[model samples]
Target: MPDLAYYASLPRTRGAAAALLLDDLGRVLLVKPTYKEGWFLPGGVIEAGESPLAACVRECEEELGLVPRLDGLVCVDWGPPRDGVDAVNVFVFAGSLTAAEIAAIRLPPDELSDHVLVAPEKVPELAPPHVSRRMEPSLRGLVEHRAVYLEDGREPGYGSAPLASAPRPGGPG
Candidate 1:
């Protein structure tokens, strides 16, 4: 028989997806929301039955008016429940944008108010503390060419180790 207590201890989390789009100059794109105070990455809570990758794709189109080809998963962070919301698994995918693509971005007035491309180092000043912390690993993942797993925007073991090896050509045997 299954242990009810053990099952109860398991985490029940919601899923959210975002895309990290970088311009040709290596700057990241941040979107200003009409309903939110700070800038954020282009994405939203994942709808039921939708894959995170698909949700990321849909969000980019809905929020930014551009269809960016998401390359790979960049960062996955487990965030604690906050503000009446349940604990959430945030998946951030990496994508690239040319200067022309960025210039053509048209914000959806109902959701986003504006968009800007800024240097990665300036993320702290432009976004919320939690968001900036989450972005750090994603940016590092972009440079390192690997995805990173995080808990509350920080790596496990205080950055001492990686949860998974970078994708290799051959299967793990």
Candidate 2:
């Protein structure tokens, strides 16, 4: 948690936001926001009618332009933990996309300037405090082990491709 100043700066509630942490070969994925020069994890506020998990999945897809398998839920941070309505709960999840899948994405222009894969040491200097806190330690552990399991799950990796039936953002039956 950091300063509660931003909370007072915003309206009662900006709603909710979700975060995803993914690492590849010791490089953590990050976004250089167009709105602000600072780097950040791929995430966004949950729209009304969207579940937090759904928002986590959708934000990554929207920010990175790809749908990744959510490996696990890492941590949750709420602001009391930022002023007016200092309630921000950040859902940190372990998520990943293969090399081929990463190649297909194009960053959404309204949100980002560019995406980069950088080491943990570089993150603190490059990203915001909130983002760095969420990303750095996980990344460090991965590098130490030299191979991170990420989570307990069954994702086929880059081998056999199976069509996913995940829900599209802002759509309903």
Candidate 3:
């Protein structure tokens, strides 16, 4: 077995923050990135020394050109290691956009190509499976006014168990 010091010396987990921005029509905002396939929430990787909430705000500004005040976290997912890539911790927060705010969206062409307000039910069809997993529960949390935990974009309880505090700033939970 690895010693405690060995475990402590392991590389730190990376984190990303995203928001589920709902419009008055109860639709969620999805972004098309220039660099990747499928639609994604308006967020990006959290920079070092940045809090997840701050990262969400910054990413929204950069990708969607909207300054939004996010509410408390809705979901925190512990993504599993995959395809040789390091595991990541993803934080999802909830924000709402007025019709005027939606109209004012000006996406950064370099990073994002398009933005759309998708109905909650259609999110599963529009987003990748894992992303949809994270998004669906997050929407529920927003409506239910509670927080939830996930593992690899799934509600903890099955293949991947959920954690009380999954992705903390300093390291993985």
Per-residue lDDT over 1-173 for candidate 1, one digit per residue giving the tens place of the 0 to 100 score: 99999988996669999999988788889999999799999999999889999999999999888889778998998988878878899999999998778878888998888888899899999898778998879988987989898988887773434435544468663
What's the true lDDT of residue 116 in model 2? 82
Question: Residue 99 in candidate 1 has what lDDT?
Answer: 73
* Estimated TM-score for each candidate: 0.83, 0.64, 0.84
Q: Judge candidate 3 at residue 128 and give its lDDT.
A: 83
Kindly give the stretch of ten consecutive residues in candidate 1 with the minimal lDDT sum.
158-167
Q: What is the lDDT of residue 94 in candidate 1?
A: 96
Listed per candidate, the RMSD to the true structure in angstroms reads 5.4, 15.1, 7.2
Candidate 2 lDDT for residue 83: 34
Top-down TM-score ranking: 3, 1, 2
Where does the lowest 10-residue lDDT sum fall in candidate 2? 147-156
lDDT of 2 by residue, 1-173 (tens): 96689866866544444454555664667778888769877777878677778888888878877777776555555534343545565556666667876687689887788988777678889976655665644443333533222211111244354335444489652
Report the error of model 3 at residue 54, Å. 0.6
Lowest summed-lDDT stretch of 10 residues in model 3? 157-166
> What ranking of all candidate models by lDDT puts the best one first?
1, 3, 2
lDDT of each: 0.88, 0.63, 0.86
